[model samples]
Target: MLTLCLAVSAHAASPDEPLFNLPLEGVHAFYPGDDPAFASVAFDDGDWPTLLVPGKWSESGVSVSTYVGWYRIRFVAPDDLPAGKLALELGLISWGDETYFNGELIGGEGFFSRTSPQLRSYAPSIYRAYPIPVGLLKPGQENVIAVRVGRHFNEGGFVGGPVQITDREPALERAEQNRNQAAAVQWVLFGIDIAALIFIGAAYFGGVRGALFWSFCAMWATHFAFIFTNSQLTYELGLQSLMVSWVGILLLGVSLYLFYDFYTRALGWGRFFPMTVLATLCALIPPIVFVVRWADWPHSLSFALDLAFQATTTSTMLWSFFCAVVAWRGGVRHAWPLAMSGLVLVVAWMAVALFASTDAVLQWGGIGVEVGAKLILLGAGVSLGIHFLDQSKRLARARESVLSAQTEERGRIARDIHDNAGQSLAAINLKLQSLQAKQARGDTVDAGDLEDALSFASVASRDLRDMSHDLAPAMTADEPLEVLLRDHAQRLGEITGTQIDVVSDGPPELGPQAKDHVYRIIQEALRNAVSHGNADRIEIVLSRQGGGLKVSIQDNGSGFDEDAAMQSDGFGLTSIRERTDLVSGRVTIEAKSGEGSVVEVFVPVG
Candidate 1:
């Protein structure tokens, strides 16, 4: 059990009453130097102005104009003091501080050098309890205590609760409990940031490398740094990196700008220039703010820079909401979810700012920040999932279409073979049987019968060859496209008894798939000219036109109406159009009744 004493009453404790409060009404302050004699009990600090203990120098009814300051407190100890190791509990000190009891050094934290005050500690709100030596206090007599504090920026001095002296064990235990309670929220937030990092890193490296995912990942990483830097654990562990928090703040603006950029693109709009300008301002402002505070400039300038930073950050959030509404109005999918998430973030942050003056809200362990991040995560995750699902559906539909086309083509080839070659072979088989019967019966066989049999055999061979050509020509990969086209034209001319001419003017450097599509388009066109248009002569030209491959097929046939040909249920022109589209090529057909017809195709080359 530890005896308690309060510093607010200024009363010395008696043995019968171990618990009493003492007020620090005699605390005095001096400015601008770190003289070693200031801590001595014999030094005269009575001429210095009185200052309020457990309060900031700015609020202590005194003007402090330098980075180093000192405070002295005089207290009387009871003659029958409690026999135990004691400690001086200074609730909190800003920046850095050191304390002395009865002209002797007790304990202190942070660098107190007046020449290099920038290297001082900055855990301004942490409870500090330093152990007091056993023989330091004089019974029934005045004891002097001195404190020196070094300020880097912002308010300085004892800025927490009242100071007191108590048993070392219980004082330290209470400090530990307070520190833990104050830092509990920061630990939880840090854990949330870690989990977010894992999930985003896994998603990015796992191939979800979209603009949204990467931007969100970067934003979360910056947020993590901000939270970690501000966390009490980082200070408790003595890991302070200068200007790291500012860097996080700077990157936050860039991340928000990137989100807006990606959002506008999703809505089919180009980059928004105002957002770009705002992001540039965000990147530029933080460094200025950091430098102003670091050099300990005028408080007015520092306040202005701080205000600018807040304004920019707040403007970014508001701009994001505006973009979301724009996207929603444009009918972009998942925009409403994102808007709702942003709404939650805006409301939470507003609450944080609104209740900043009250300890009740500040002590919630930053639930607002955590909840805002979680909501954004939910929105981004849902959006990504929906995008992936849509991509999968499109891919599946394309696969199904390709498979259906392949099946339809195979059936077309089977029917052609069965109808043309099958009948021709049957006629040839019957004619051979008749010739064999005549020879076996010893009857006079006529030359006409042999001639008829030979003709039927020729017809069957021609039909089989045409069917083979329709399936695919026997050509090597290295064969020139013009050679294939000319060969195909010659074969068609032999069957149709028409004059076919093929001319190549320029190189058509195309891939294998593109070449196949071109060949099919030409085949379809040639068949249409002969079978449908009853053409007698056909002319084909291959050339390069305007950085693309051009193929033109013309025939002096009794041409049919172009619109009617395209609209008819026949597969000739329809197949031509389909093949052209497959290769990302364009085709135009020109025809008139009793006039010549032309089919021209243009395909781009890499």
Candidate 2:
């Protein structure tokens, strides 16, 4: 018989206790190679060196010869142990491990048959629990347990633990609860990704569409896939699961880069090709990493690949932080959240890289990879939502502005009809009535009276025709914009007796819609000059300069306060600004009291 001494302090057994936590007092390990005889009960490990339990072999005080190691531990069962099937529960084991109870093969993962030792079979970040046979333990007697571990990466052997022996029923119940908790967390994350994807997709397809929105959708979609592959559903896939997860992560990086690319552009920072280059690298690196890892590439090569993966991901995060800060400093809307999110990601990465050896730092700080990831998602979602809402609000205000302008124009048209056409018709009717009265009294009517009636009728017809023309300009679609503007300026000048000059020099070939807006802008400016400014001279210039079309309307009218006009609910200058914005152009108004006003518009062409 081989007797192993465990320096566990004696404690009285209690039947009511749910389980027993086997003390880590006397665990022995042998390094470098594996032997089937090492699992036999008669084999003596007395000469082997002692090691720390509930810890990795690499970190334990003893040195490990190779990637393979064997650990032997002895524990005594309680005298009052329940009369039921028992179980041995160990938390996560890095890479792989095989367990034997009293020389009988019981359970394992990654590490398989004594000769095979399949290291690729590892299941990461999962709890380990194996059922013990009914007669495997003798009450109040010592029991020996042996474990074979194969190290693939990081720290090997039992890297995670609360190693214990317990009743099979209780252990199963606890395992189920733990699994449910883990699964719940995974499902929650998956649901968040789904919700974000749906929102972004709808925004992209439903009118607020842009490159920025599309990239957000893609990022969330990739994250959803990553969550799926990393979840329990893919645990049986072993190494392939990790590969798929990595691929998803890499693709997510690509999406993030694209997102910032468009985001910066929207903020008026222009596009940076380096961002595109990083995105391309992220897109191309995944396949190579996947293939090499799947082919079981040399450890050093694999390490290099891992290093590259980390490098790209970290670089992407740093770049995101840089962009966010720059945007915020530049007074970009919806930028603060992005900056906060980037900071969180950087902090999380630092914590994982520097303090991953222990859980204490993450727990105490209440921030880790999981927390940081969720924060980032929250920040992004909030940012997108705010932008959408802002756009919708602006759109609503623009619609109201347009409706107000239409109503005011209709009022002006009504006033013109009543003042000009109505009065002329009334005068003709009065003259005819006077002619009938003179004929009734036997006095002949003068031919000059008939001529006066004809003149009044002609005036009415002209005013009506002018109103019709104002409703819709009589011009073909192919007509140049300058021709239409000059006709409008001439007509307005003929009516108001103002000297109007329209100088055109290489006017831009804007689309029909843009031309309409430009025409309306000039018309409003002219009307404002005639009515508000009471100016007698106006000059309109159309020219091409600096890759843009410049429309300058200068009037020697009684100009009002530009600031006050912009601040008020007036329609003329406001309409000009809104129309310019619709076509992605800029408008500037220079005016002072009793001097002159200059309204200049710049619209990018080509």
Candidate 3:
């Protein structure tokens, strides 16, 4: 049985060890070769696969291009070993890794460019194992260990220690703690991704540049979901392991494409679209290579793919930078959040990519990968939060604008009534008082003159009532708008001495604004007909046609030219046109000399 015990000091291979002294040709020789005493696995290699010990691939004569491959090492536990826990320590895997001890699955880790190292630390919950349990071993025999490693572009892997055996509980505890921490980090990443989706969805639904934002967000969510599932933080739906691992990278490419679209539109970088398309296409290259024959591709090709990945990431960063600069230059206050959030994301991604490429720090059970992923995720969260806040502010501004407009409209109505209708009413009251005084003093008064005065007074009263109704209509509840039209026509006939007829055929129920605007437009049209057109008979028709409301007002009187009327500097036509425009409606005027005019307005309510 393999027994693991704690040593007072860190375990190191003896300098005299034969494996260390072997004049291993090339970097591969230094690595535990297929020989059981050293290493026993040979992964499919293409394009210069590196054979390096637990250190920087660069030092092992392996360029960054030679990062992905299968690694195997062989070791034999002594037959006399105590039956207890045993442990194997690895430094860090670049993007992600899977390890098997003596054909028994040990653990795996995966990384995300958008997530932070801290978040990555907690990601893999299921794949993490405390220590290579002695129970997993066939006692005192040769054991084969294999590792399948994948990396991001420009990042190469396996930068720490090789296989080591120990029974130390402290070491085992530390390993377990790391695995637990990684699992936690993964959960956090998942949470942040979920939050991003919700925020973007809300932004889109709220009419805040939703299409572009949601497209980018959807792609990101898909990519992260693949990473989470593949990394064993969550259960994977059935698929080959290699396919599962590479799927996220493929998704990342797609996300970057959408992100480019969003960023370009946001920043007004129209010229970048071609480049964005190119980058998206370039992203497909790696997946294609992997699909064609993942085993046959040299490490260099994989490295090149990693470089492309980095390039894509860098392009996204550049796009973000451009947006920040544009916003800053434009003096848009809201741009700062986007700029800062983007900066954080870029910086976080760079830090992880750099850490993954170097062994400046010790790797004890995939801690580095965890740290990098967490940092990226934290940055993503910050960026997403900023986006949400900006959207909220924009909505607030739009609502305020609407409210301000409404307030100004009410004020204008008040002033119009105060200046015109109010003064007229006061004059009528004075005339009435004078007539009453004359009658009370027994002064001679003509009955006809008194009747004329009373008629004038009645006209003033009717005008005042019409003005009041115009300011605040009695029907606040939704009713068929035809009711309001009929009421208006009746009032117009009583006041103008002109025969007014309102005809309706299947009029649709209108929203408040639509109803209000139509009423005001008709009121204005009637006023113009009486004061300007000198028309005796007016016909108002309200009907629905082609999913819209059509209002027509025709007058039988001597008509003026349309151009002359428009140049007369009157508010009636202008006001009607403006109201119709507010609801994206259209207006047409048909009039000529000696013929009555027809004003046709089509208002879309939907």
Give the candidate number with the greatest lDDT: 2
Kindly give the number of clashing pairs for every candidate.
6, 0, 49
| Cα RMSD (angstroms) for every candidate in the order listed | 12.8, 10.6, 13.6
TM-score of 2: 0.59
Per-model CA lDDT versus the true structure? 0.66, 0.67, 0.56
lDDT by residue for model 3 (30-121), tens: 23112222222343233424466454545555445543445665556566665555556564455455567766667666532212111122
In model 2, where do residues sit more than 4 Å from their true spots?
A: 1-27, 30-51, 57-84, 95-124, 133-156, 164-166, 197-207, 236-268, 279-287, 360-368, 403-576, 583-606
lDDT ranking, high to low:
2, 1, 3
Candidate 1's residue-wise lDDT over 205-277, tens digit each? 6666544555566566665665565566665675655555456445555555554544543333434567667
TM-score of 3: 0.49
Error of 1 at 290 (Å): 2.8
RMSD of 1: 12.8
What value does the lDDT take at residue 52 in candidate 3?
62
